[model samples]
Target: MPTSSTGSNPGYVPRAAVRRRRPAQPTRARTDLARLATRLTERDVWLTEMLHEHKVLTSHHITALAFTGHRTANRRLRELYFMGVVDSFRPLRTAGSAPEHYTLGKAGAELLAARAGVDLPATGWRKDACARIAFSPTLEHTLGINALLVRLAANDHLPLWLSERSATRLWGDWIHPDAYAHHGAAESDQLLPFFLEYDTGSYNLARLEAKLPGYAALAATTGTRTPLLIHTATARREAALRRRLAEPADRLDLPLATGNAQLADPAADSWLPLDSTGPATGRLTLSQLSTHWTNVTPALTPDTTMPTTGRPTTLPWRPIPPRPPADRT
Candidate 1:
């Protein structure tokens, strides 16, 4: 593993990363007649759009979000991968089987652009770019964050999900969180807007700590606070992070909490607040987090007092099976 200046091990890049290459094959794995008859399903297009937006997603993430089961999702994904509409890779896992990670393939990008009446460049789809992302050191972190969002979507607890690409449009080149989201709508008008930091405990603690000033500056500019949720690999890492967070600093009044990888569910009541002086309270869910730490502020936009709820005017992709019927007799 290579180490960056920050002393954190670069994300795991396996030998397969450099060896994998795009085959000079046609875009359709099925016969021309079958392809013509079926064309592209709505779900197929939706999957591509998701990959484009999120950069990378595991097969399980896609299944939980789009299909009824792993078998169905896996079958479709394999077809798509062979058709050149999606690219996939399985990294080296230390333990059990590793899930296949998927990215937008060349044909998929073209399909998205055609559907949207936009050009290829506008779609930002490049075979090389997809390969680069697949091999990037931060690939694991990216997939981990997507997994969190997928779990939320599975429970219909995710009302809005803004990929880093969409978030960059608001914050520009500065202060890009892993993801910007609002915990699914609640009974109260409370729209919880926050940023997720899916730390792998790879980088130097000091380098990670250095990012605090940027968040503080972002808050100062927007005139509102944004809660940052961190999910780390271990309790020891979380403690070290909390200690660094405790250091005195001006205008850094942001609510912070830490969770670990061993957590069965990231959105469950598993986070420990940094500023809590009392003995450790139980874990807090995403919805409960906002209220649990009153000091944590909702994200804001610089131009207006509007909350950064991350809700798009139109949902980019529709969730499947729609929420179950309202108790129909």
Candidate 2:
């Protein structure tokens, strides 16, 4: 065949002269992940576990749970994020800087699976999935739950944190709490299990009211009424929810309370008994909830409602090793 005069078959564009878009190389994250495996520490492992359980967390929450200070948490988290051990996205905010919210990344999931001797799923977590949660309608509600956990974890009293995912796994589909938790001083002084309902003031009141009966039914079935605690965004929302709870038709014998989420410490003396008309001054700590509501028995150990197969009572990792003391010299 005769070539066109530029390289030239007439009007033919040579393949060498064709502008082609090269396929993007695999992300740096894939190759960088191997370094994370060798550099992983116990603290890093625990952070991954927390992200897996909670689904997402702000750096502040991660610091409160794992590190001694903000700077260290930020530094370590930045490293982990880049190494593909965690992924993060910051949601749009009209005022003030929004903190980056993080979730388990592929490497983190693989590390966890290896630590637990389980196979990692073929398709693990994706950044887009986590990013959607940061921008989702439930973002504020999820943060409210995180706020509660942060405060509880900071206190000297030992608290056990359980995510809604684990709660659903254990308790099945009947009632899905925003979170489930237990606060205690000692084995005997421990408070009963409780389910948290974080209200963002975005849902219909009737829908909120409808769930009360289900809670009551859950109480009856378990032979123990686990207090259903509602944390509302504002005092108005709290008041409105309280009024809804007070309705004669809506009232159930279940132990319930509502708290303003803006309070300094949600787990403290902010929860007011929904059934009380005396005053809000008698708010109780989470553990003290039992002291005020005597009719309801404490939740059974490993709640009877827990489904046999799905209950994951412990993290794949052991208790976080205590941080070594800094050298005084």
Candidate 3:
């Protein structure tokens, strides 16, 4: 080997000639649809479906809807987050921390798409779904809508809850309500289905009154009167809204009512009809609302059945998530 370049043996390599390997970087947990299919419970699937439909839900909202306690919900949510089935973000606030808001993650979208027999793109989920919802100007409004529904859902009386997107999908051409729900006593067959308009008091009274025409148009076109329940942030706002809306509501024969959001029980005697004449001694319960609006027919059941020539079809949205299984212990 002719002295071998240095004093090293023929098989020995110099330190400079030796290749240095960088430390192995950790890899993220890969989301496997098959693995998730095997691992996810019915309740987990329901939560994901809810996230898909609702756009976003706070940790508190999720807990109220499904979990018995915050600890349990948080632990399970963390597991879901690691599994990439859901994404969450806590907004920056001036004082204290905000609850983690959850939105459908990539894995969740894939899971829902499979369940719906559609491709991922067809599900309308994007990689930035969480960020989009977190930064949107309507975040507060969205949460308000969800907060009201969560309270109703907690009572186990909310059978059908349609998010604004779904509601718009079904009736966007006619009117846009904050939400649509069918609520009643858990044991009763009767349900009170209505269009909910959650007013934050940001809109002027005139602006609020302008929405009545679209609702009137919807009622006239469908020939099915759906009560419009306006939930105001304060009693003063409710009073002003009632005053402004009363005339249009009556003239159009729109079955409408106003309620203060401060009421503890939304289903209780909290709703005041716009057409009430005498002193407001007592308010009406949600179930009693249909009774008050005598001509208002029962909400049309979710159906795909083709309608006769002139009538509008009520396209269905996903039903409310099934209640968590009873504790066997």
Candidate 4:
């Protein structure tokens, strides 16, 4: 039987030449966080930050916490509440008929607590801190991102810092990033050493291209040492992610296989990926647990209620101003 001459013809289309369409961008049902400039004064932002930072607040009790002025405190309380950044103050405390204490809601606290971890079921302190941190869906997102950050920080492969979404607060409508990454920003105080962001799902390159100008502007304000990083490692969506990784803007992208990945210490000249059995090819995952998590979330049970008893001592952010050098004669 003679083969079809058409198969040998130059005009015949190869099976691989079939038409292929571009992959659709991943969609995330993100929230719209309204950050009105007028909503809060700088003092208000500071107070809100403090409230979220500690996950508890009492204006009457926090005279030396982070800022001064009752008016400032009142202003922040009103602004944070109005902007929906906060749910309600602790135990709904109030004076003269109105609520006073500034407590983070499930979302507000979680959003601001971006450096904190939120894996409640797996860890103990993390669950408690997250519970104490209060519930904020935005915060929840940030919590996940921060958790990843802490993990990265622990990796000997890299020295990571806070960056992108959490630091500059430009996460589109979704106040919190899906992950935490590093960025270099300028802060006179040493408390906020860096900035970073975490975003899950694949995004269109052109869309992010548009956000660069704004990101660049923010970067200019950050310190010289800051560098921005963004990561997405959803195992279920790796192929789509890999395509995005090929884009030009992805030069800074760091790859983590999530459960499939293992980070190596830089001192080691060789690296080994996990073997089929799931055991680390080179070193054990970790024999000892670490206590360096930035924040932990705890779920509220019947036993866990608003911490009762007496007033709690407030911790102040005081770093002795860097000592000036002394000259030797």
The C-alpha RMSD of each candidate to the native structure, in angstroms, is: 6.9, 14.0, 16.4, 23.7
The residue-level lDDT of candidate 3 at 245 comes to: 80
Task: List clashing residue pairs in candidate 2.
Answer: 3-8, 3-9, 4-8, 4-9, 5-8
The CA lDDT of each predicted structure is: 0.65, 0.63, 0.72, 0.32
TM-scores of all models? 0.76, 0.77, 0.82, 0.29
1-329: candidate 4 lDDT, tens digit per residue: 11111112334221211111224545433223344433434444444454444344444433323334566645655555655454443321122122234454433443433323332121122313434444443433343343343333323222223233223233333223232332111221211122233443435545533443443443334312222223333434433433443443333221112121122321222211212323344421221101111221111112422322352222222211111122111
The true-versus-predicted C-alpha distance at residue 54 of model 2, in Å, is 1.0
Score candidate 2 by lDDT: 0.63
- Candidate 4, 213: how far from true, in Å? 4.0
C-alpha lDDT (0 to 100) for residue 296 of candidate 3: 63
lDDT of 2 by residue, 1-329 (tens): 11111111123221211111224657653444456678977678777777777777777777666667778888888888766688776654333344557788777877776666665652245546665665565555566676676677666443556777766665554577787776665365446557888777778778778777877776777677777888877888888878777873235666788887557676578888876544455778877876666655544354234344343333342322112122111
Query: For model 1, how does the per-residue alpha-carbon lDDT over 141-235 read when each residue is reduced to its tens digit?
Result: 67767776777776777666778766666665458677777675744545567888778887878877777777788878867777777778778
216, model 2: CA deviation in Å?
1.8
Error of 4 at 246 (Å): 4.0
| lDDT value for model 1 | 0.65
Which is better, 1 or 2, measured by lDDT? 1
